[model samples]
Target: MDFTDHVVVGVDGSSTSIAAAVWARDIARAGHWPLGIVYTQGMAPDVREMLGEGGTLMCVESTLAPALVQASRTAAMVVMASRGQGSTVLPIVDAAAEAVLQEAAGPVVVLPYTTWNTLDRPLVLGLDAERPSPASIRFAVSVAGRTGARLKVIVDDKGQGPDRARLQTVQVLTRVLGSDLPETFDVEVSAHELTDALLAKASEASLTVVGSQHARRSTERERSENRLLLRLSTSPVAVVANTVEAGQADGSATR
Candidate 1:
């Protein structure tokens, strides 16, 4: 259960699952972390061959959601396909992925089947100007540092001036990241809705990170927006659990 230095991915033999495995492999390779594969249904032999040697394989008896939830406890990050083999619909995340997003204890990356090649692209962080999550910020910074990608922080604010937006973002970043902030980073404040802003930027990003208050029940609107981004974003979407307390900096601005 201790996967602190591993990039864990859930595989179900679907094309999307295979793609998620590949993405996890690349991330593990970049960070010099081991790759852990968890299979609840079953894993394809081809997937094993594709991954090659030295990856840990886990076969769980429970469902995908429970297995992933347990793995997320100490895993560096848990990766899953937006939709599995049971789903044929477009623009909708599968049940297991949605459940994991709502309950996973750590960061979860949901990769859609249409995920674009993200090499050398910027890492997009969708920040809530009002209530930024420290956990989200640290994860984004760590990933950007490992991949040598520019960290682009997108803040969704209506009626706020660009200068004010930048100031607020900087204050939050400084408070959370301190001297660990990436050397190359920029802030973008948009008046558009959070989903719209992230969608526009995701087209050119390697990965888009959003904070969610997974410890508590999320509003229906919040769930809808997260699903929309997971379904339509051009890149893999990381749903990091916001550890901030409720009512005070709950990190809902990006939700």
Candidate 2:
């Protein structure tokens, strides 16, 4: 759909969770999308209280869901986090979110339940020499579109920037429902070092998306840059798993 669509945010009711909720509210408002707050109970007492016998599971979900609907452009199930483990570390949060916001996967801005942290905005998707997962791009685009946030894809790849490979990725994005592919999308080209350029852009953007290179196959250098992004970038980070085409063995796309 459009950026006016809704975004699904995960919370844990912890201070961090609350912060996530608040952050989601702001994003929703900016993007003109309804905010969805889901409280995870992967921990304990929290989920138990919500689902334990003589618990308030039904009552709570009913009350919170509708109330959220009222106060927010639209609110949804505010249940305790569930119990599980899978593709993600926070399986509970992931599962609960997948259930409530299926087909509504515009973007899932995860606000970790870590204390003493500020939520960042104006998401910056780091364009790697290696292409990002199509699914990840789809998710990122949805959030960017909804928030009316500007997108800056960093092409830190060497060689000719994988011209052919990147072109296909670009082609797919153009077809997506919400893509503001301006003539030039904050393009960047770096030979080796990317600290200065990345820091500069990260400083301005609210978020950054980095392809999560698996250690099993990553070179010492690739691993180093990924770590650098985590430590250097000032904005919140979204680590996307590798999903580039075989042709683009190196991160760069040469058109």
Candidate 3:
């Protein structure tokens, strides 16, 4: 199958997984990109019924990481439900889903089964003041643009004072967005823990964007925080690669 720009979603028979598939369908339709529904083991009959027509459907009996890696080889972005089939009550991040986000070469969007509706909220971007990633910023902005939502950028203090953190975030935003920074874009520096601050602000967000902390050289603490955020987020989370791929694709890179 031609996988260029395809929206690939992983399904595991959960309602949240179906929601992810539906969201991916909308994204694929909007962008004129093909959609691919991937499942290993089994799929819900209702999910098959809900995913009526168009796009490619692949079923494999392999494990999660291998399946996700194979999907990543072809997919521009991988979408997965935050929780798995066995999850009940709250949807916490599972090992299989974490593996996908950790190793996926491209972007991975995690859809959570939140009780609270988040369809009309703003988009939140998590910026690492010590080392801001342009790709994450660009991706967040692009998504906010598409969703017609305001963009709120949050800077992780990581031990810096509020004033210093704000300056660092402003510098990174200026460097990445230039004069094109939308009037709806807002940036703030937070004194709370990265995950805590993001989650606290997530109530006002339909989606949150953060840099992928899965690289080999990333500190254990950073990786752990990212994973924790993935697990506990009430809003959808888009984990973008740290490279400037999004800026390059949109011809907005200052580099």
Candidate 4:
């Protein structure tokens, strides 16, 4: 796919998910970029019965999938909130994030919620961990253009794991933004303090962009818990995975 103009989002069977879908679609349309959504139900027969008739949940594929595709360069994905967010401050990413963070081959944007922090403040794409893919940069650029929000490239502790990664990440970011990304992009090198740093910046920003770790989820419980913590935070979140949500076209389910 032409990732240079694609945007993806993760959705669960939650009520708030709809808002995220709508918001993502709106932004995608505004930017004229391809938008995609993903929803995953895993191998749980009970979940399949709970979400659908067969052993797999079809609500997402049949319901909200289409809308996502039509929205510029966008797609939708739905996974079991396998890990959902955790209850702690540094919770893990649920099933949805695991799939996106690990499998999404592009700069993925992990959004916790779709509709929030619509304030007219500056928008910052937090690159605390993993290098962004083409998708991530496209999402950030599209978001900034659509919202008219000043975009900042944020470097949190996650991006500074080792000296090599830190330097390489900064170099990548610099290449991504070129003259657009000013030298003032906030650099937070503290460990667990990333949450605080992000939250503090969120207070002054219209929104913050991040990636999901669930895509790399190895354990169900751990991933679920982290997603919960992220969901509970003050900032809105976006989760990206390798899958897409085709059911969104019918506009029947949430994102």
Which prediction has more favorable TM-score, 2 or 3? 3
Expressed as tens digits, the lDDT of each residue in 1-32 for candidate 3 is 44555778888777778788887776565445
**Candidate 2 residue-wise lDDT, 42-123, digit = tens:** 4335543433332122112322222222321222112111221232454323443333222221222333323223334456
Q: Which residue pairs show backbone clashes in model 1?
A: none
Best by TM-score: 1
- Would you estimate the TM-scores of all the predictions? 0.88, 0.48, 0.79, 0.48
Please list the C-alpha lDDT of all candidates, in the order they appear. Answer: 0.76, 0.41, 0.70, 0.44
Tens-digit lDDT track of model 4 for 17-63: 54554455555554454554444354234333433431212334333
After superposition, which runs of candidate 4 have C-alpha atoms over 4 Å from their true positions? Answer: 1-13, 34-93, 107-115, 127-142, 154-176, 179-192, 211-232, 238-255
Best by lDDT: 1
- When sorted by lDDT, best at the front, the candidate numbers are 1, 3, 4, 2
What's the number of clashes in each of the models? 0, 20, 0, 77
Pick the winner on lDDT between candidates 2 and 4: 4
